[model samples]
Target chain A: MPEPKALPFSARDATCPFDPAAELYELQEREGLPRVPVPSPIMGEFEAVELTRYTDAKDAMSDPRLQMGFVFDPEQPRTMMNQPGNLLNYNGADHRRLRRMLTSAFTVKRIRGLLPKIEEIVDSRLDALEAAGPGADIVHEFSTPIPTLVICELLGVPYEDRESFQRRAKIGLDVNTTREEQIANLAEMDAYMGRLVAEHRRSPGDNLLGSVVRDFGDQLTEDELTGIGNMLLVAGHETTASMLSSGVALLLQNPDQLAVVRDDPEAVGDAVEELLRYCSPAIALPREAAEDMVVNGQWIEKGERVVTSLLVANRRIPGAEGDLDVLDVRRTPAPHVTFGYGPHQCLGQQLARAELRVALPALFKRFPTLALGVPEDEVDYRTTALVFAVNKLPVTW
Target chain B: MTLKVEVDEQRCVSAGHCVTSAPDVFDQRDDDGVVHLLDGAPPERRHEQVREAALLCPAAAILLRERDGSA
Candidate 1:
């Protein structure tokens, strides 16, 4: 196919780092969707028309004609990218079959059950941060470890084996990595998670993987189990970690908002929604148009690829009471597309929400006077990554 | 005012946004976590929450229709 437009868009804004690239918002106001090129090692390269408006983004996503990603091919050897159990890899009936098997484990009620554990995890991380006594990297001390440890406990993956999965998870999400490197990392992850699945088979624990094994072991293939295990590990941790670190960075820059998050017990829930909507950590997967469809009056032909800047959509969301560009924690939450929309919407969303609700407030409450340990511009932000994040967040209380 | 609700169990990926938005009107199936509509035709007071729940549903599983209620 002829290469689409050369209108490649940067994911981040130069001036306001919390927002999507300014061009995306500009594109939202323009006459039509622009064809944007996305190059990735795993899926090679593809050109897609971006849907920037909130209504368009939501409609295009939930529309049945626009599929999640490539359909899972049973003939192909299962890799991290194309596997049986990973819901992101399939569409329609096949997708529902895999997703239903684990839905019980990720329900809002099930996730709420983990609140005590999540609270414990958050407090321990705060203790580590306090002991380090400021000038510490919150990425390391607070953000990264909380979700990592939470997923570990939830999946029954040995926390000691986090080293094996964490590094590869980062490698997998790095868009700059080569195909060979990605393939090698995928294999390593496959084997690592495969062992964890095997371990669960022998004696099922009360965690997610354990519960799946207990209920659906007869139905699930080994590859499916491994895929589900690793998908949760990768999807569950890094996104939340980035959100935590970046949200903290965003909050710290706006002290009044930070105060709202810290002092107000009833407002933290509202605050996390604003943070998710404002920061927009999860970059949505580029979608393939399964059939010709019109999104917000723009005609998209069949076989076309479509993309979305979720950050822009969140900011442009209709019915929001205040300025979209500014951050307001106490404002009523808008229905943002941060967790994405449609059938492939994030499975661990409730768990992620619960984690942030507990973690973010607890971090600030523990250290009443937290401030950036380094110059504002000195903080390294991970912009080009699949998940927008902070490389290291240096802070002092 | 009566708020009538319908849910497509097939479409729900169990994102749980519906339940979060309107817990009294919606719930999740314990077995599959798909949406479980607790109140199909709710009273006037619940109309707003139920509307919010339908809008917030990521899967777009919840659909709402309105009809005048008879006292």
Candidate 2:
């Protein structure tokens, strides 16, 4: 087989943090699906077909023959991947089975029921932000805690353990972290989740994990419960937290759009959707071809990997309205694969949307004159993580 | 101009796009969280919003049939 060509693909542009690297857009214009070298800390460097167009992305993601389980090497000792209930570790029937177990936990109705609690969390965080006065790191003071606390409450994880879990979650998502560090962090989190699962086994509470123990305890193994807890714990907060911080920075840059999101209560939902499309938090969703297939006219052999760039796919030309690359909160709702597409699309999307819909507008309403504490150029954007986010958004009202 | 709407519960992922678009016409069952059609034939004025709701459904589970037999 001929060697795959290496393409320059970075998650975000240094010049424009919100946009994908210009080279990716150029590649999309020329070749919609190009084979490129993707480096992983666990598996080192390998070739994967990169899908950049919106239609092609949806097609590849939705194709059952393309499986997510093959993305990781069989030899890898990653605990999360080896575990049973880690949804990303399985495909087809196994994936559907595991996914069905948790579906009700994140349903729109269930999430809406949590709104009062979410509002309380948002309000308390806003109160803390107010007490901190101006020049606080919005990332640490505001963005991180709301989701952290909410997810903790949902999963029945003790609020006191958040700092440790949050740290591990950060290490887990960072692409630049060494494989050893990733394994160590995953091990620590697994141990922690094991204890939580054991506690729930003794006495189930009202939260998701507790409910699982109560409802499906006999059907599930201890490892499965731990894996489920860890997946929800990490995925529950990290993506939404990244969106919160980065969304703030994006809104801060576009003041007029910020005004629309803040002033019009009815517009918050659409604004959140526009922000999800524009920001494109989770960068790429990786899958592997289980069989020989042609996607967007590009042939792929069995066992070859395919990675969909959510950033580029969502930003494809002729967006919902006006330019796809630009951030306009007023744009009509356009379908973007930010949460991904197909059967394995984000299960927590409704929950994430609920948090964003409430958190963004509430933050802006509480601090109407919010602006960046540092100059625009100096804001640190996390470039090497699976999820795109700001390192620290220093802000002042 | 009443509109007929039906939801295939098996296909629904509970993305909530339908309910968000037209809360009055669509909701989710409290138990499994699948889409529950609150109004099979909504009023004339709500047809456009119901159509938008069907379009927004990621699962394509929501089917709308207009009174004229047009979907």
Candidate 3:
């Protein structure tokens, strides 16, 4: 295979914002895993191998040799990465130790326990949307707040502090933000989490953070507790919020699929899976090779970075059924690397699934005639961010 | 028919997919969330749910085999 082109991190096809860049797909088809330049705000630009095949992406995610800790440059003051107990900053035993602490909080049974609250939150959001009248930005009025509030309750964040926390989280996740801004946002959130952790230490609530404080207060340090709180607060809301907004936009584009999600109760689970695969909220997850190893027949040297394009890999050939690129809610759920794969597969996926299942159906069912308030092409999709999302999804009944 | 169930502790992230799918057959330790097989040889009636639990294990940690050396 010829030397692959050095593509920028934010390069996506402008014509089809939903799909990965044409160059990425073409390179993957020609050379299963292509070498490309990955630009990181904290680490600057560096060469990294891109995994585009779904099978390879899934398998490589579990490879012990591929470490996530080195994704950031050590010299740079990555406050978020340096935070103790941040799962993404660790691999192997350390990662497992931190992860296990919160695993019980996100177990299927625990998530199922939270279903009633999730439903109530979804219903309340819908009520607000309706009362606001038609022509509301679904991203703001509906998609964003539901997960934000749910996470607030889960992390024991005060309801009054949600808006400020949400603002900081959005800024923290934005790749477009400057290093100074990112650090500032992280510091602010860190302080907020510290206060919350202290409060939990005195009297732990039933929420995730509080439970950890109550159960293992002696084992965990203040920094570790705050880190756990920060990770959940940001990840719990932002990723799901992206899916909610983008999933709605994608459904509107295909009314046939929309009808299936809206009307068929049995199809909701599969619909959420399909949407997760189709939307590919978090574009790529970056990992560093802990040691030299062969991944998908490519020789990746130790310390080299490997970035897997979840968006492209999920949409690769031989998908669920029919064309992988097309949105079909009725299609059987095929394994995709959207929530990622391996031991580190998303901790809160079940909760995210429950949110989508309840929220999407209720949104469409409540307003059967719900349509895009703006032109389809005019819908502003987020391109430069780590997560693929729409800027605003304006809709009307 | 009897179901022989095993959980690879190293691979298990304690997502609880197995526990949720087959509660009677699987349980998790209090110290860590990793699952443990409650009934190694469950009756024939629970075969399907046990298999479903194995299939749903996100980490691919759950393994099931029959006494006759069949999966």
Candidate 4:
């Protein structure tokens, strides 16, 4: 593969946690693929296309030619345990059907109804932090607990086993863990979810897992349930938890932004939207072209694998006008591709929003003087992480 | 004239930008993840934000029009 030349722009280098678009856009100009290649052993085997331009990325997302359900060979580096009929590996009507069923669970009203529960979870976790006194790692003590507990509660996973479940969830994403270790963690989670579902089947609860089993009992096979459960575990917990830790840290680092959020709690909604756009946690997911298509004069053939960087697309581009990159909550109408676009956008977006809305404001309301416990330089940025996050975020109140 | 907004469900991507922009009038449903119009018209004060939502609707599904007793 030929390396593309860098573009002439001075955006934040890839290292800057605040704005990493400069380097990303440069890669976009380079042969239209981000220089940071998708880490897949099958790079030579598959035709990899990188969609970085705003129009191209959005087009790729909405294009019917792109298949969402294509499962790369399991031997590939990023392959998870293969389960047939999982939502991630479906396209067209199948994708639509699964999305319809799951989207309902994440509706704003449903999520809003869970606000009190979300608050309880956030506050209880915060209480634990306060009891532990200063210098507590907020990521482990506060951030992880809220979402972990929320997912467990939502999926009818017993809260008693939460700490262990949280440990397994983290290990599931640990790069340091050998592939075998990761696979083991996945199997453990699957088994736990399997047992939890079985218990729910014997005596159904009001949570999402029971609902799925009840409504789609005949439709969802055992493996399907496990796949959906695992999807929820990763999507329902990791994304929200990462946002809480990193978003709060970003606000703390940018005191001006934090002050804006503090002055008017109403800004929490806007701040959360901005944070989604700014951080764009899940950087790239593999997408394959279902048919030949043209995007911005570039022709892409069928059966091609393309990765869209929502991170870079959310930021300002050289040819694009307006402040797409700026993290301004007050922007009258913000346009962000954080939750994604088209048919497969985000099933849990409203739920994620609700979690953020409740958690961020509650944190400030409880600890008005909250600030980062450690210096910004001392903080660890999950740079190589697929889901942008921090391992530890210590905050002082 | 009482202004009203409508989202063509077919074109709607369930982005919930409408809900975020004008939560009082537009809310997403807990089942099937469809957008529900809470009120025909938001409070007169929030009319501006609603207008902004119509313009920002990527799918162009949201339509804003003035309503009178006789249409």
Predicted structure with the largest TM-score when compared to the true one: 1
Question: What TM-score number comes out for model 3?
Answer: 0.91
lDDT of model 1 at position A319: 85
Tens-digit lDDT string for candidate 3 (A263-349): 899889889988998878775457888788887677888888888878788887453578888888888776677888777888888
Q: What tens-digit string does per-residue lDDT give for candidate 2 at A1-397?
A: 5432222354577687788888788778885467888876555677888887888888887788988764334476754445656888787667767777788888777888999999999999999999998999999988899999999999999989888888888888766656788788888988999999999999998889998888889988987898899999989999999999988998998899989888998999889989998888785546889899998688988999888787888887343678887888898878888887766778899999989989998999999889999999999887777777788989988
Ranking by TM-score: 1, 2, 3, 4
| TM-score, first chain, each model | 0.95, 0.95, 0.94, 0.87
Q: Would you list the C-alpha lDDT of every candidate in the order shown?
A: 0.84, 0.82, 0.81, 0.70
Judged by TM-score relative to the true structure, which candidate is superior, 1 or 4? Answer: 1
lDDT of 3 at B56: 54
List the DockQ of the predictions in order.
0.86, 0.49, 0.50, 0.42
Screening candidate 4 with a backbone cut-off below 3 angstroms (N, C-alpha, C), the clashing residue pairs are A65-A290, A69-A89, A69-A90, A104-B32
Candidate 1 on A1-397: residue-level lDDT in tens? 5422112343777655676776787898999888877887776787888888888988888888888667667676445567667778788888888889888988989999889989999998888988888689999998999999998898888888877688999888888777788878988988998988998899988798999999999999998898888898999899999999988998898899999988888999989998888888777777788888788778998999888778788987888888877888888997888988888888888998899999888888888889999888888887767788899988986
- CAPRI tier of model 3: medium
Give stretches of model 2 more than 4 Å off: A1-10, A70-76, A317-319, B1-6, B39-44, B63-71
Candidate 1 vs candidate 4: the lDDT winner is: 1
Over 4 Å off, model 1: A1-10, A73-79, B68-71
What TM-score would each prediction reach against the true structure?
Answer: 0.95, 0.92, 0.91, 0.84
